[model samples]
Target: MRYIIVTGTSRGLGEAIATQLLEKGTKLISISRKPNEQLIEKAKYLTIPFDFYSFDLQEIHQIESFMEKIFSNIDVTNVSSIHLINNAGMLAPMKPLERSESEQLIANVHVNLVAPMLLSSAFMKHTKGWNIDKRIINISSGAGQKPYFGWGAYCTTKAGINMLTKCIALEETDKEYPVKVISFAPGVVDTNMQAEIRQTPKEDFIQVERFLTLKENDHLLSPDYVAKAVIELLETNHFDQGGIIRIDEQ
Candidate 1:
């Protein structure tokens, strides 16, 4: 049996991924600020095993214990593999860095970068003895590779996530059981995050018009489409460790 833990399952791509996995009969544990009612109802209707945790990833200090509790609840017997999808993120404080508030900057970093790192570390440490297949999918963005005006915090944090994936892969090279990791850029998706982007003022985001046009022309990819790609990556046997994979490229 495969066990997968996905973050940001309250809505958007994370919710779509969790829903698909449930239909596939995998044991799923989802984390978000609030539980997705649709997922709960679907899991019940299908008689599938589902665990939902309402967690604020910004609480970095409690992550270790939180992860421990999650693992403790699972019966690892007869488990084939475990996977982590670091999908929770925020694109807030979308303004010039100099004009951004200190609290918002720190919060963005904590949610986007710090929390994923801490969660990955805890996952590796807790599963150190398990010799099963382990994998991590860090949901990254194109912004990480290319800078956008007024997206200073978001861009920097995503770049950090890419590097973090590489660093983890490098460290696991000699381990008897290495957790395969990959950074995934889902491209422009139609989600609440995109809605926020479209709302950005021209002064804050010079490319605001470009995003507005994308929405107008229906150029954005659907969350379900991107989620399917992520699910494919999870079930596939071949994965490039530390590689940055893009949905558009696939």
Candidate 2:
């Protein structure tokens, strides 16, 4: 049985991914702020609630606890038998450079960059040289690939994640491990995150109207679409090199 771990399972893209994985007969360990009652009923899985929002990974103590708990819950008997999906993230309260909030930046960096990196490291440490097929799929963004002004902190954290993925993959290759590390952009998904983005002030967002238009015009990809695509990549052995994959490309 495939043991897959996914974060941000309270809703949106994360929940969708978990559902798809469950449907494919993958045993799941889901992490999120809260449980999705409907989704939990739809699939059999395990849930871990971590307050990444409030506790934040910026603090050293919380991270120590978080890392300890992860290893405690996950048993590493056979190597690379698990799939770790770093899907938890947030993009909210968009504002121009001068008006940006420090708390937001801190929170974004904690959730988007620090937590995923630490979690990946912990997983690797526990399962090193197990001689099994495994994967670390970091859910990233197009904003991370390029740029967007008002999304300063969000973009910064995402860009950090992209570079982190490359560095982690390189390290794995240097050590001669077969664990696949993929950094993927799942496209403009219609989720609570999008709704939060839409709430950004008009003058602050460069393409504010365009973003809203896309949402209203039904141009946004459903969370399920991206979720299924991620599952497909995880199931298939196509991404052995740990290259970046986008939703449209998948």
Candidates in order, TM-scores: namely 0.98, 0.88
Lowest-lDDT window of 10 residues in candidate 1? 17-26
For candidate 2, report its TM-score: 0.88
Worst 10 residues of 2 by lDDT: 46-55
| lDDT of every model, 2 decimals | 0.93, 0.76
Model 1, runs deviating above 4 Å = none
Which lDDT tens digits does candidate 2 get at residues 1-250? 5678788887899988877766443557777777777667666343422222223444534665676776676546532367889999988548776887788777777888888988888778766776777789999998887778688888888888888888888888866555678898999999998888788778888778888999889999998888888887787866745576678776
Per-structure clash totals for the candidates:
0, 1
Residue 37, model 2: Cα distance from true site in angstroms: 1.8
